[model samples]
Target: MSQRQRYAIIGTGALGGLYGAMLARGGHEVHFLLRSDFDHVTKHGLKIESHLGDFELSSVNTHATVDSMPACDVTIVALKTTQNRLLEELLTSPTRDGGVVLVLQNGLDVEADSAAVVGADRVLGGTCFLCTNKVGPGHIRHIDYGRIVFGNYSGALSPAAVRIAEEMVTAGIDANATDDLLLTRWRKLMWNIPFNGLSVALDATTKQLVDDPHAVALIEKIIQEVHGAAAASGIEIPETMIDKTIDSTRTMIPYDSSMRIDYLNRRPMEIEAIFGNPLRAAKKVGAEMPRVEMLYQQLKFIEAMRCDTC
Candidate 1:
């Protein structure tokens, strides 16, 4: 077996916990830098109920702060963009020279922020196509689909990206590496723009949106706008991805989007990253995304209300 790389999970939410646990299970030295659930995770360790399988780590390295953790070969930043203000402090501590920072985040231009702290050469963008949630402290429920498509922010796959992809594949994650990170980011935005937006704006789950014909049509319209936006920005998303995304969602387990979950939990939503940033990027290139713009406005209002009350 190839040597396992030491990994640090910067956020122990769904993305961090699931992937970090899999890495630990694959025999990698994994350290989880936790926060609110630090005591629980420290005592009971990590627990995951995944479609792939159920697993438990009775004893794993857990730390409350980055300063308490050892430097690692790869650090996965899975924090929601809402908490990104903390990145300037949290990103630099747990990585070593020549180590890579893998950003498993949502929305556009996320890696650049990480790159600002870590050199651009040491950063990789990982787009996760999965339905998993942290149901409780130290516990995550993986609903379905766990494929992670990796791309380099520098426009070409680097050795670090390849090594991380190989490690993920060994850990049982459906992983792939792509050369065009911008194209890959646009591809992810194609799905994220409509579903995450409508799911929160309309107060519905993935199933509800797909089952209703009216909602389905709206989704298609939003997707068309996204395609135009991508093209306006010089990135081309295939026309067929719209149908494929809708069909895939139709078959997914009745799941609450991360945005919807945030809405229900009264936490701040990731409006800027998922919707606002994409909208600005589109408008800069002369693309008119009326549907997306409207959704963005609604979400902004909803985000304000959620924050005010919570």
Candidate 2:
């Protein structure tokens, strides 16, 4: 393979920890910029358990803040959508230079937001297709398939993006760089928007949501609305593709959506990033999306409830 490049993971949670650990174990120089959990992670390294297998790294580099991070070739940002502002601060800090920020976030607008801070040339778009969770400090549980679709949003295929994808594949993580990164992000959001919100609203698993005929039809309606909104915005998502996506989810392990997990734990929800954006896009293009609007409002109300409880 190519010479091992220096890399850093900005968020040491489920997705970050799993990918970072695998890359480090493959002998790449890897570092992590974490928050308050740095001490525990440093002392014990990262532990990953998956249906594929389980493993632990004996020594993994970690820092609590960006001020302490060393210059690296690339930084994979696995932060939640709500933490985008904080990520902007970290990316703009002098500690990062001559490096690309690969965003492994859930939503679609991260590329534009990151471009505002670090310029479009330094930002790469990526979407992770996996079901994993940080079960505890230093422990991550991988629930299903792991794949990454990434590329430069400006349409210029950068050498860095290609190299990163190669390294990830070499480390046993399925990854590919695409010229149509925006479509990939939108496709992932199509699944995340309805299922995530409905799961939170009903306190159900993916299987539970699909099993209820009424809930299943509701999800299909939401998908149709999203498909319409996307087409209106000049992003054409075929109707048949939606059915294929739902079929893919059926094979995934029965698990609670991230939104439900966050709600149960009283953490901030990503309603705005996931649901609100598409609705706004629909409005921008003069498309009506009443069902999407309703779901978005419901998720917003849920967010307000969580805040009030806090």
Candidate 3:
């Protein structure tokens, strides 16, 4: 990859739209794969209102299908894990150009899926600490933190990873390449397994969950359970990270997590990807995540019931 590489954003929702628009704004050639927003974004382009700044692209290169999109150097998979079944087709479009595929979704072993399609050498997994919402067609509202930590799924850092992170930094994103991809993933899960699960299971915002004594206790237990699983998997998360995740959420703006939003809209939340995968991984490693299991069960039940009115 060059200093200015051609990029394709596979899922142009909140994450893709915001980061892809930022890349375009930073003067990179970005192609967006949009569905419902294809016509809207083609005409109106993309819009992002962020704490860092506000910007819009009046003329965006948009595509409605993977076959229609041109080959690019970096293809970002921002689709929800629920839509991962569509990845093999979408990724082939960019990998044909001999570019790397970055899996920018949540949960463990996500990159493995991408690696299976594109080969591990060409696959990178990124963890996003970004808070954003697609407020309208071609519009994204940035709420809080917007940092991305990415690493090669096959182990060891590569020059491409470094260059890509540097390019994103130039694009004004807090991006870094980590040498330990799996361990970094475990770190990310420290926050995600609890918050994303509870947000849907408890039907509570980050603030509300952290504010209530009972919720906070449950949240802590879930976090510890996740940490235990990580340890069982041979990746030991630092002790201090537990407190940091809690403090950061307590101070950040109150917000509804992505899973919560999915539930509220009656869309399928990432239950299997976020919870099922980790639990099974833990079980294989002989680790029992009773609290995390409870939370996962609660979310599964809520997922079954949240659509009762439908």
Candidate 4:
């Protein structure tokens, strides 16, 4: 077992709640910065339903804001990228000097934005391959898979990244550490770009998307575009990865993507981080992705419509 470290979870959503609950159950000191569910979680604690098993923390260290939380050894920033503008205050407030800020959100180049607030040396990018969701307040349903890949954002082997991975592994998560941050981001985006965007655009599940012939063809085009973008950015993602992702999704439980779920619930989706940013990056490097560009424009329209109604 690894030594237990103090951990703080900002944005107690599906990702944050699941990982933080696992850590707290493993005997780590886990504090949660919650907004609406602070009272319910503080009273009823956190409940996790996983295929691995089910567990409930009768009580956890909970706070409504970062100011009320204590400095911790590592802070997991799991907030959706849509809420990233709030990260400066959330990260710098309760994170101690030299404390690790593990960014466990989705999208490309996300770590750089957070690293701007927390030092690059203190930021570690994390990619989660978990199928999980917050079924209700203080409750999470882990559908399947819970592996994490962490990378040093400072271009070196980060001691903080290694230690944080140890803690995650100790808590029964499949965790690994890497030295290449940009490559990690690009690789994760390979899966995120096609599945997430198409899921929203088509209003379909993973199985539904893969089951359609036209959808399958469109998915490949998006993957190839992402491959080109990654190569132009000086990161090479194998073309074989596209087939592997398709094969894996065929076996996955029919699931609505995060973007699709967000759109259904009328919450803001992560259009800019996942599509707009990557599209702009590819364009800057002279990579043309007409399909991806079309998807970006459509998402932008949906987002604008949502905001106008608000």
Candidate 1, residue 109: the lDDT equals: 85
Estimate, for each residue in 1-310, the C-alpha lDDT of model 4 and write its tens digit.
4457899999999899999999998889999999989999999999999988999998889999888899998989999999988998898877898788889988877887788998887888888988998998899999989888988777787777787888788898888998877777888888888999888777789899999999999998988888889999899878898888888999998788898888888788888888988988998999998888888888777766664322
lDDT of each: 0.89, 0.82, 0.89, 0.87
Per-candidate Cα RMSD to the true structure, in Å, reads 1.4, 1.7, 1.7, 1.5
How many pairs of residues collide in model 4? 0
Candidate 2 lDDT, tens digit per residue, 1-310?
A: 5679888888889898999898998789888887867889889888999866899997989888777778877888888878887866776542267888888888767677777777788889898888999998889999898889999968677898999899889888899998878688788888998789888877788898887889888888888888887788788777897787777778778887887888888888878778877777779889887887888888788878775443
Relative to the unseen true structure, what is the Cα RMSD of model 2?
A: 1.7
Clash numbers, per candidate: 0, 0, 0, 0
Better of 1 and 4 by lDDT: 1
- Each candidate structure's TM-score, on Cα atoms with residue i matched to residue i, is 0.97, 0.95, 0.96, 0.96
In lDDT terms, how accurate is model 3? 0.89
Per-residue lDDT of model 1, residues 247-294, tens digit only: 988888888988888898888888899888888898888889999999
The local lDDT score (0 to 100) that residue 138 gets in candidate 1 is 95
Which regions of candidate 4 are displaced past 4 Å? 1-3, 307-310
Candidate 3 at residue 261, lDDT? 91
